[model samples]
Target: MLIAHLSDLHIRPQGMLYQGLVDSNTMCEQAIAHLNKLLPRPDVVIITGDLVDEGLPQEYAMARELLAGIEQPLLMIPGNHDDRTLMGSTFSQPYLSSTAGPWHFVADDLGPVRIIGVDVTVPLEHHGDMTEAAGAWLDAALAQEPTRPTLVMLHQPPFLSGIPYIDTYACRNSERLREVVQRYPAIERVVCGHIHRSMQLRFGGTVLCTAPSTTTAIGLALDAEAEEASYVEPPALLLHHWKVDTGLITHWVPIGTFRGPLPFA
Candidate 1:
């Protein structure tokens, strides 16, 4: 199965732009168009979070319209920039393993993979957290099929990236979340989007990584005095393909103009 992952759309109103530079809406539209034309079309698309620049009702309306171009099943969670009620109302679903929460969803429909999306969005805050109940629900979902290939997705990453500024908003329940994740070996990858740049780490026997934003990227600054934001890197997404015999493989897909392979070989 092929799962296309993109994040941090931060889609704004028709004329508005993110950070006075990146045109998030146009970037997303182009991404949708590009994904639609890929060979062996993706079975589903999982957007990690930051679907809008602001958590406004109007933004959700615009987001829904732009995302309508996706030809495959779309699954989303919430980010610090998303409003739970508005997003949930806009994107309705009934195939989830548990409908107990507004942002958590579990999709088992994929032939060989199960998708478990958890909401760690903390209202009015840039950081992320998960209630004990959320952990319980996740435990139940993974416990249901311990040996099945599962992908756990959330907006904020459960592990820390070297960028100290962004790490300030790291998931608050990482310790607890890690405990739960470590107990389950079926989890192939813990995917997320928040840092707005591609990064990978090992956590709880699983690979924890963050996807680059569709709009702009957050620069990698490991120094203690570095600022919070920067856009020196190109935007990108992740493509994950899974097989029963070989586990899961991930490829970083960059967006925008580039030179072609001239058949140098």
Candidate 2:
């Protein structure tokens, strides 16, 4: 099925601009409008996380309104910036229960490739962590559908991407996560956000894909002496499609006003 994978919206209030440069809210609204206008709309939309710049109640309200334009099922997990209780309240979907610490949800059926969302958000922290229980839940979910094609969605990546700044705050206990994933051959992909740049890597014989930020991108500096943030890159999102038999395919769709029907034959 076609799935629109978006992450790092960081949607702020209407008048508040992000980093004094981009209007984060408007950018996200534009993305939603664009998605609505796509010819064959995605069957589902999985939001990796950092739905808001900070997990404010008002932010969640604004986020809910901004995301209402999505015409299909919308699934979300928490990021380091998200507050689990508040997000869970605003999310309000029956599947987003707090019993799992972070919302760990699974599809009841395997007809369209099962999807499970793992929450790695840690309150008042800039890093992510997966509890032992969370790892066990992941194991159980995979066990439930050993032969079905499955995709795992989380906010923080389980593997390092060479960006030292982000790597410092990446998902803690990655070894545990890797161990769980290696045991599950049914997992076709692992999707994450937070790096703010589109990246791909091989982990546990599965593809780990990170979408670009809806607000701005984190520059990819594999090694640098200075530790700071830069805004040289533009905003973007990801479109992923998968089927039980076909595996996964992803596209990096940039977010902005583009006029493209250029001839490229």
Candidate 3:
């Protein structure tokens, strides 16, 4: 099964770009249109977070309408720029029956794969945290048998990406998140999105990948010693393909066309 992993749309009014610089809405529109034209449409669309620049009701309303056009099942979580209560109330569809828990944790079974999503937004904080409640919920979810090849999706990454600005606001209790993953051997990959850059790291023996946002990306400044590092980069997303017989393979597909279409067939 193929899954489209997208994040950080940061949708806002047409004229309202972050700090009056980036045109994120246009980027999001381009990404969605490209997604619609993929040869094998994604089995699911997992948006890690930062759905809005400011967690406003109007922003969420606009995002809700834009994403509603997707043809596949969609999942989401909250990032630093999102309001948990508002997000929960806005997107309310479950993969299973309504008897399951609320909007915090969502799980969907796609044939031989099980995709589980968790929200880690900390109210009023720019950083994110995987609370004790969320850990316990994950533990319980992992305990279930008939565990198909599992993929855990969240907003903030549990591991550092060698960048100070992004690491400072990453998942606070990463060890707790890792411990739970170690317990669940079925977990094949832990995918996340808040970094706004494509990255790969190892956590609890599972492959941890951070997908770049569909909006503007913060450049890789792992070595820059400046107080605040910044750079402009292309927006991108991830396409993750999982096979029960084989394993999970993810491709970082950058949105928008570049200068060339080199024919390599």
Candidate 3: list runs displaced more than 4 Å.
Answer: 95-103, 258-263
Clashing pairs in 1: none
> For model 2, what is the alpha-carbon lDDT of residue 256?
66
> Which candidate gets the maximum TM-score versus the true structure?
1
Candidate 2: how large is its RMSD? Answer: 1.9
In terms of lDDT, which candidate is strongest? 1
lDDT of each: 0.85, 0.82, 0.79
Q: Candidate 2 — what's its lDDT?
A: 0.82
Counted clashes in each candidate structure: 0, 0, 0
Point out where model 1 deviates above 4 Å. 96-100
Question: Which of 1 and 2 is the better model by lDDT?
Answer: 1
lDDT of 1 by residue, 151-256 (tens): 9999998777878899999888788888899999889999999989888888888898788888878877888888877773666779999987888888898876
Candidate 3 structure quality by residue, lDDT tens digits, 184-227: 77788898888888889788978899888777677677764635
Q: What lDDT does model 3 reach? A: 0.79
Model 3 residue 49 CA deviation in Å: 0.9
Candidate 2 has a TM-score of: 0.93
